[model samples]
Structures are given as C-alpha cells and as structure tokens.
Target: MPKKKSTFFNSVRFRIMAIMIVLGIVPSLVIAKAVIHSYEKRAVSLRISNVRNQCDILCNQLVGVGYLENPSSKVIERQLEVLSNVYSGRILVINHSFKIIKDTYGLDEGKTVIAADVIRCLQGEVTSDYNKKNKYIELTVPIKDPEQQEQQGVMLISISTGEIASSVELLERNGMFFWAIIAVAVVLISYMASRVLVKPFNKITKAIEEITDGYQKEDILVEDYTETELITDAFNKMLNRMKILDESRQEFVSNVSHELKTPMTSMKVLADSLVGQQGVPEELYQEFLQDITMEIDRENKIITDLLSLVKLDKKASDLRVEHLHIDDLLELILKRLRPIADKRNIDLILDCFRPVEADVDEVKFTLAISNLVENGIKYNVDDGWVRVSLDADHKYFYVMVADSGMGIPEESLERIFERFYRVDKSHSREIGGTGLGLSIARSSVLMHHGTLNVSSKEEEGTTFTVRIPLSYIP
Candidate 1:
C-alpha cells in the first residue's frame, strides 16, 4: 500500500494566509477601478467647460465691436492664440456653415469640416462632445446679435482631450503602487500575528510531547498570553490530572505486587517444609497444609475485593436497585459482624436515631457495611468500642461507623479510601486484611450517589461517615 500525501494548503497557516490575500486583494482592485473612473469623468467635464467659456468670451469680444458679420481673421486668430497658450492644446473656431474661421494649429483655415459634432452645432443646438478620432473635446456656443434679436453664427472651440486619458492612466499607476505597498505591509503583519497566535499552542504541544516521553513533572509557563489563558488553564489542568493518574497507577502496581508476594511466599515456605529431608511429621504436615489454605484464602479475598471495585466503577444503571430500610440494613450488617467483634473483645454498639430508608443494591451495600464494621473490630484494642449510628437530615441519611482503635494520621486520611492503601502496612497484613476494605466501602457508597468521608487523629480514633442522598433513593 502506498502512503497518502497531505496537501500543504490544508494546513492552518496556509488557510490563514489565503484568507488574508483574498480580503486584501479584492478591495484594493475594486478601489482602483472606482478611482480611475471618477478621475476620468471629472477631467473630461472640466476640459469641455473650459473650452466653452473661452469660445463664449471670444464671441462677446467680436460682438462688442459690431464686427459680428465679418469678424477680422486677425482678431479671431489673436483670441485663439491667447486661449491656446492658457490651455495645453490646440483650439479651432468654426462657423455654422462648417467652414473653419480660425485655427490655433494653423491647418484648418478656409476648410469645410465634416465632423458629426460640427454638423450638429450648425443646426443651432449647443454641443460639447468628444471626437474619439482626434482625441479632442469640441464645444459649440451660438453667437447672437443683440440689436437684431436673432442668432448669428456658431462659435466652436476644439481642444485636445488626451490629457484626460493621461491623467486617468497616472491615477491607475499610483493606485497599483499604493496597493503593492499595502499588500507587503499586510503580509508582514499577518505573519507576525499568526506567530503570536500559535505560540501558546506550540507550548501546549511541546508539553504534551514531553508527557508522552515520560517527562511529566514540568509545569507549563507562558508569559504575556492573556488571549490564550483559558486554553492554557485547561491544558495545565489536564496535565495535573494525568500526573495524578500516573501516581495512582504506580501505587496500584506496587500494592498488587506486595499483596501477591505475601501469599506466594507463605505457600513456598509451607511446601518446602512438607518436603524437607527430615521426614515430615504428620501433625507438622497438617500445619503446613493449614498455612497453605490460609494463604489461598487471602488471595481469594484480594481477588474478590478487586472484582467488587471494578463493578462499582461501572454505571449505576447496571446495578439492581431496591428500597430497603436503613435501620434494618444496619442491624443485619452488625449482626453478621458480631462474631468477629466477639473474638476481638470489641463492643459493637448501635445508636439508631431514625428509621431512615434508602434505595440501593442490597448485596453490595451489605458487603460494604460489613467490611467497615469488621475492620473496626479487627483493628481495635481489646474491649475497644465500635459505634454504628444512623441519622437523617433534610435530604440525606447519614451512617457513621466510629472505632476507638489505632487511628489514622491526618495526612493519610484522604488516601485511606484508595485501593490497597493502609495506614500501617505491617499491621494490616498481620490482621489478614487485603487492604481494599475502605476502597470497596467508598465505591459502594458512591453507587448510591452518596459521599464517604473519614476523619482521624493518630492514636485517638477514626470516624467514617457515609451520607446517602434521598434523591438517589427510590
């Protein structure tokens, strides 16, 4: 099978750059087109206005001298010369008969003009139009004799309009240059902005990579990054969670190894004793068999505890729920653990203040409460007291088991409910505890959406409180 190649344009950086180009380029082109069109229109209108004004002034000068019928050619030539010098183009004056009366370029004298605009002006309509053939603007103003109250002849003026085209071309060139500068500046700014945006993401990625490589102790530090603080905070929180989970995994492995080793070591010792060279006595062999049986029993307890913990981690919907009287349940659990209490010489006291009821899985709840009561009696001093009490608040029932035995340290209090965690490892093993008692108890309580908490002071006593909410009860 061949590997597929990824397209570079699919990357985020490429997409961002593409967006900037589209946003920057389209508007620049539109603005350039508009500016060129506006400048061209204004230039043509101003040139035509200037030529019309000049022709009107020349006609007025001729009429004032009463020489409108046969104006001197020298006079018209002088007027055309003045206008041509003021404007940057040639000017021509023609009559209503389309005959050239005066020419600033000195080439149209006594010539009959056959232009469309000139023919229109000869019909007595005022005209200001462009001649595309010669690139000139032609304007015609009607000459009137005030004494006769009638129209005389047309005063036509023509000027080159190529200057308007040149001005529009210059504007377009400048617009292109300005947009080029803007594009360069925008590209630089986009690059800098993308870098600033991706910096925090890079830091997060590097931190994750370090974690994958088993370097999880480092904390993420990004400065001057207020815009990405939320993302950074979430990343840091995930890292902290992973660190805690890693520690938990290591502790579970260590605890399992220790639990398994004790039983296997005992089995090995017993088997060796039974097969020793000194022919094994029957009674001693029975003792060895009893030891093996006890170790097997311990292993069975550890396996049972592990299975219960797994079940508790599953969804509550999987467990069969039923309504049971809290007082009745406690009575049954204490009765079942009474023999252990008797063997240890510990007094199991029950203080029931209310007949509280809750809905929960009966078998799991019984096992959890049994473990707590048994632990209280098993670890207590001779004649020590284990108190089981029940109380109810507005929305929950509280079951508290307090024992006057070797109490836990304040620092280790929270970790007591962790799997296979024991305050005194040697003492727990001597008492035949699988060290998963409190963990199972906590999980069972959580299945009912309840909370399990413990408070203890070393050498004083320990109190385990289980609060079950009424909402969780059917």
Candidate 2:
C-alpha cells in the first residue's frame, strides 16, 4: 500500500508567505534606524543654535548700557540668571584675562577658565563644542567694549543635550511600535497574496491526484489565469497526449483479442471435423489436416508479428546503419519475389533511378519493401501490374510502389498500417494474409528513421511511398 501524503505546511501558499516575510523584515528595520538617527541630529543642532542667539543678545545689551568698563559680578550674575531661566540652559561670563566673572549656577566665580570654547572666545573669536564633559552644546561669543571698539570679555553658554536625547528616545520607541505593526500587516498581506496566487495550482494538483487514483478523465478547470497560462497549456497538452496513449492501448487490446480468436476458432472447427466419431475417408482427412495446418500457420504468424513488434519497439536503437544503394537492394528483393508474381500471372515492373542510396539497416529496410511488394501482388487481380519506382532529391530518397489491385476505401487508408486492420477481411483471409503485414512494414520503416505513407481510392489503385533522409547515411 502507498503511504498517505502529509498536508501540514505542504502547500505553496504557506511557503510563499514564509519567504516574503523573511525577505521584507530586515530592510524595514534598517530604514527605521536611519530615520531615528536623522531626527536626533536635527534636534541637537536646533538646541545649540537657540542657545547661541540668546547669548549674543545679552552681550550686546551689556555693552549698550555702558557696563563694559568693569561690570560688577552681581550685575552680570543677575543678567545671566534671567537668560538661563528663559532658555533653560547654563550661562557663564569669562573676561579677557580668562577668569570666570559670572556663572548662572554660581559654581566658579574666581576660577581660571580651561574650557576650549572659552579660551577661543577670550581671544576674540566665537566657538562652540558639541562633545564636552558637561554633555552640552558649549558656545562662546566675544564681548566688545563699544566705546573702545575692542573686546573686553566673552559670554559663554552651555545648553544641555538631555532634551534632544529624550525626544530622540521617544521617537525611537514610537518607531519600534510602528515597525511591529507594519511587520504584522506585511505577513498578513503576504499570506493573503500567496493564497490567491496558489489557488489555481491547488486545483491542478487536485486534478492530478484524481488521475492518480484512476479517475483518468478528470480535468483541471481554471479561468483567466494569464500569469500561469504557459504552465496550464503545457499541462493540458500532456493530458491530451496521455488520452491518445490510453485510446491506443485499448485499441491494441481489442485487436490482439480478435486476431487470436479467429485462428483459435478455425483450429477448433477443423479439429472437431477430423476427430468426430463418424469414420473419415483418407482424402477428407488430408483436407482437414491441411485446414488445421493452415490455421496453425496463421496463429504462428500472428504470434511472430507480435514478437517482432515487441523487439522493434525495444531494440530500434540497436539497428545496424550503413550506406547502401537502394536500387540494388530493391532489385534483389524483386528478383526473389518474382517467382510468386509469375505464379499469379502478375506483371512486375521496376523503374530504377540509378545509384539511389540511403542510410538504413539492410535487413529492416528490405523487410519493409518486401512487405509492400508482396502486399501489392497478393491483393492484385490475376495478370494485373505492379510498378516500383525510385525518386530522389538533394535531401531525400523515395521508394514508391503502385499496384492495380482491389484498392482500399478512402476512409481505411490511414488505418491500414494499424495492427490487425484489414480493409477486405474476406480477401485477406482468402489470400492467407495475416493483417500484421502493413503494421510490420510501418514499424520497420520507422526503425530507419523514415516515413511510409499510403494513398488509395476504392476500385482504382493504391500507392505506397517510403521516404528516407539522405543525410542520415552513416
């Protein structure tokens, strides 16, 4: 017994959905990281700019109020406290001598400044630092004495990066949540798409399974699936071919049964006539024996033809191929069959195209041609004519045999080469013809990689044409 097939995850729909999920997740995560990074950088830069502008405004105000000569620490401290409260950032004032004069947090009132941005500001230049020990945007703006037109000191500002970092972390968390939602949506959409895409294939698979279970006529029905039309077309073509093969198989069985039954019936009748208790005369016994012998020969011929067909089917590739003159070969075959033709008063004629040659197996090629010639003679009226001719072109060699015989019906011409198909059953049996002759002839011609065709009209005549490719010569 065959094992049952497993269905868990065995469908194309599931596999396609899995593949899409795996391929889409990584790139989405990378894009989310980049977006978060860009937002954080912009936030930090904006905070730094705002703090710098506030410090510039305070320095200008102090100079305008005539407090630059030696501004008291308490007055500077008051200004710094108001600005720091408004901007939410630390403020520091450093003098030209690099001394901290005022600080909003009041951490260093008399200490010398060592910060890089403060040192540059004391030298009459504006500077800023982003990466500093204070984790802030540190900036310095030069303080000029308005009446002297010279720098008296610099104002330093430090804005904390904590707000930027906090916003960035929040945005990143929200982005993660959004990405999770997107991933789930993607998987659901992929699963839906895969289900739609594989629906037709599932139908086809079911049809095939039905065929496997002996429902040979089942068909896959799909509508308007343009994307998979090629697959559908190929599958339909294969099924059509299988249908033809099945029909041929049934016909073969029928033909074999009929062919075997006829001879067995004949033998049984002849045996009964000879062995019946009514005493038989010597002359009648001889006739009954002859009848039995004929039937036995007919049975043997059928079996021989069947065995030959089997061998040809199996060993066609093993035939010996060689270059031989077709004219000489035909002449030899005709000479051998001439005695039979003479006995029937049939006129045998040959129209030889000189030096016609082809690549073919000698024995098989002769057998095919001999069968055609014999068929012509066997079917012809006494003293009727049979003509054999050779025609050739650059690419092909043709052997045609025409006989003035009881020609086949137009409808039966095509099936004449089918095993056990006889157009004139009574005539065939009268002439001791086993219906396998044309079938064997066709198979032999096919073994040489050639074609054999017949044309006939009732009561007129029949012509058999055999074409062999010249280039196929060894």
Candidate 3:
C-alpha cells in the first residue's frame, strides 16, 4: 500500500470547500448582522416617535385645561393618571421653574425633577433615547402654551421595548437557519466541482504509473483539456526520443561486437595456421605477419574513430573557443587532406569569396571540415575534381564541398550521417572506412549550433554544405 500524506487540508476538494464556506457564510453573516442592526434601529425610532406623540397629546390637554397653573385640579390629575397607565410607564410634568407639578406614579409629585433632558425640553428642545439593555424608550417633549407663544413646561415619558426586541431575536434565528442550509449547499457544489476538475489529472497519473511499471511504450492520448494535451504531447515526444536512443545504443553495441570479432577471428586463424605448420617458409611468415598487422591497425582505427565521435557528441560547454579565420580553417583542412587525394589523382581545389573572422573551437571545426573533404577524395573516381568553397552572409558563414564522386542515392541521403551506416559495405571496408566519420563531423558542427546538409546524385556528383554561426554562444 502507498503511504498516505497528511493532505486532507492540502487536497483540491478541501480547498474548494474552504473557499465556498468563506463565500457562503461570511457574506451571509455580514448581511444578517446589518439587517438585524437596521431593524433594531428602526424599531427603537418608531417606539420613541410613538411616545413623543402620546406625550404631545397629553401636554396639549394639560395646557387646554390650565392644569400646570393649578395642579390640584381633580380632572387634570385623573387625565394624567389615565395617560401614564395607557403608555405603560411613569410620566413627569415639570414647569418652567423645574419643579415637578405632578408625577403619574405619585412619588415625585411635589419634588423637583432637575435633569438635563428636562432642562433641554423646557428650552424648546426635544430629546429621546432607547436603553436596549434595560428595555425602555425615553422621550422628553415641550409643553407649548399658545397664548405665551413658547414652551411652558416639559413632559417626560418612559415606555417599555420588550416586543420589538423579541421579534428581532426571532428574525436572527431564522436568518442563521437559512444560512446554515446555504453553507451545506456550497459544500456539496464545491465537492462535485473539484471532482470534475481533478478527474483528468487522476487519469494522467494512472497513465504515468503504467509507464513507470514498464508496461506500455504507446503515447498517452489524453485530449481532455488543453493543458493536459500539452503535457501528453511533450511526454510522448520525450518517450519516443528515449526509445530511439535506446534502440540506437543496442544496435551500436551489436555492430561493435561483430566488427571487432571479425578481425580478431582472422588473426587467430592465421596464428593457428602458423602454429600447425612444422616449417613455415620465410615469405609465408612475412605475409602472415603483415596481414595480422593490417587487421590490428583496422581494429585500432575503429576504436579511435568511435572515441572521437563520442567526444564530439558531447555538449558544447566543453568547447575551447577563440577568434579564428574561416578562410584559414578551410585552407588548413584541404592542405592536410591534399596528400591523400594526390595518391588517387583526385584534384583538390579551394575557393574563397571573402575573408571572415568567427568565434569557434578551432580543433573541433577543423576536424569536422577535414572529414567532409577526406570523404570527397576517398569516394571520388580516379582523376575526379573536389572543390571547396567558403562564403558568408551577415549572420552565418558557409562551406560547400562538391566532389565528382560516386554520389549517394536519394533514399540514403538522410541516413548517411547516421553512425556505422555505409552505402557500399564492401567498398567501405576495403577503403579502411569505419563509417563514423560523417556522423562525427555532423555532431561536431551541430555542437557549435551549425547545420550540415548534403545533396547528391548517383554516378554524377555529391555536394556537402556546412553552415556555422559566426559567434559561439557558450
């Protein structure tokens, strides 16, 4: 069983659920709080307004009956008694002297009610308050005397606010219940959405797992989303490249074994023939030793070429770069290979259009151009001409090698640079060719970020073009 990580808080579903909860619950709570506060404020304002209106009506009646001027009137006392009872709180009537004329509760009837609210009301100001914790609304209104054209006294009324408080509490409970339901719905939706989003990734995991277990070499054909498609495309390309490299490696090993064993077997047979002979002639002995020496040289040449190709195939980070002349480099390669060409009577020619200076690893570049020119001389018919040309544009310098050789066929052009690939196997072996020269040359040029191309026609001629940047980046 696979080990499980502490990933519940890290998973997609959990994260989505967390986001939904924040979206659903936080806003719901804020709106609920705002609504409750608004309702409470409105209810208190309505209660205070009602008390103010009730106090105004009673104050008008007191003024009409001349109650404040003569407070001992039985009719005024009865009216005040009824008003306080109906409003459900005590009422105080204070005159301009700030003395309580009559208290509906009968306790502060003959006492002075000197309060800030009462003083303000006597000066024609109205003030009110609702004490939510104590459950009461207080309002002080002016008692106007029409004859005096001013407030003659103040009427203070205090009423209970239990009903509005009870109703608001009920509404808050209902809002919370509705929000609870919405939060649950958010959780369910987030879970389903996360599942849908993560399904493709789960399938991709399975595909990779199968590959890891050494099961399939097929491309993962997932086309669910654009991101997944890009991933699959890149992964399939990498997989194809790895397979090609692996196959190439295996074929190279098989070819090396066969090639190395052939010469060794010949040497062993020749040695055994000498050993079995009682009196081997001096001439025979000399000939056998030369043959063995030739085979040894051939084997050593193959190993040396293989090593050079291996080194050339490495990354360009190892290049020993310096400023070199393109013309000089080409001249050096042709000058060295001219002696070999002279033996076969193949004329070697060089054409320089302009003198170009470039930043390149001189040794690697020289080896690469030498391989091309050498092949041109080796593969050509007797007395054929080999031409080397150098030209450059603003961006890149070019070298073209044209030879009147037995040219390559159309189909074999592409594979000609592949390692150990030979057009004529017998002729290649007879000419002491190890079949790694072109491959090494191409790799070396490519390491310098260059392009090498070939165009040829059978029995007519062949031309090779090499393009290299004037500057080396790395």
Q: Across residues 1-474, which tens digit of lDDT does each residue of candidate 3 receive?
A: 998795878887688778877887789889988999999999889778877776777778888888888876787778777767776788888888888888778788778878999988877789997899988888898988767868788888887777888888899899889888988887788888878887887888789889978935588877899988998899888889888898989999998888788889999999999999988999999999999999999889889888888888677788988899889888888888889999999999999999989988888889888889989998999999999999999989999999999999899999989888899899877877888889989998898899999999999999999999998877
lDDT at 145, model 1? 62
- Select the stronger candidate by lDDT from 1 and 2: 2
* Cα TM-score per model: 0.72, 0.83, 0.80
Alpha-carbon runs more than 4 Å astray in model 1: 1-15, 34-38, 65-233, 315-317, 344-349, 383-385, 404-415, 456-461
Give the 10-residue window scoring lowest on summed lDDT in candidate 1. Answer: 62-71
lDDT of 1 by residue, 178-295 (tens): 9899899878877777666666767776766776788645766565477556666777788888888989889888888888888899899889867774866788888889989999
**C-alpha positional error of residue 300 in candidate 1 after TM-score superposition, expressed in Å:** 2.2
Winner on TM-score (1 vs 2): 2
lDDT of each: 0.78, 0.81, 0.87
What lDDT is reached at residue 252 by model 2? 89
Cand. 3 TM to true fold: 0.80
Clashing residue pairs in candidate 2 are none
CA shift at 247, candidate 3, in angstroms?
3.2
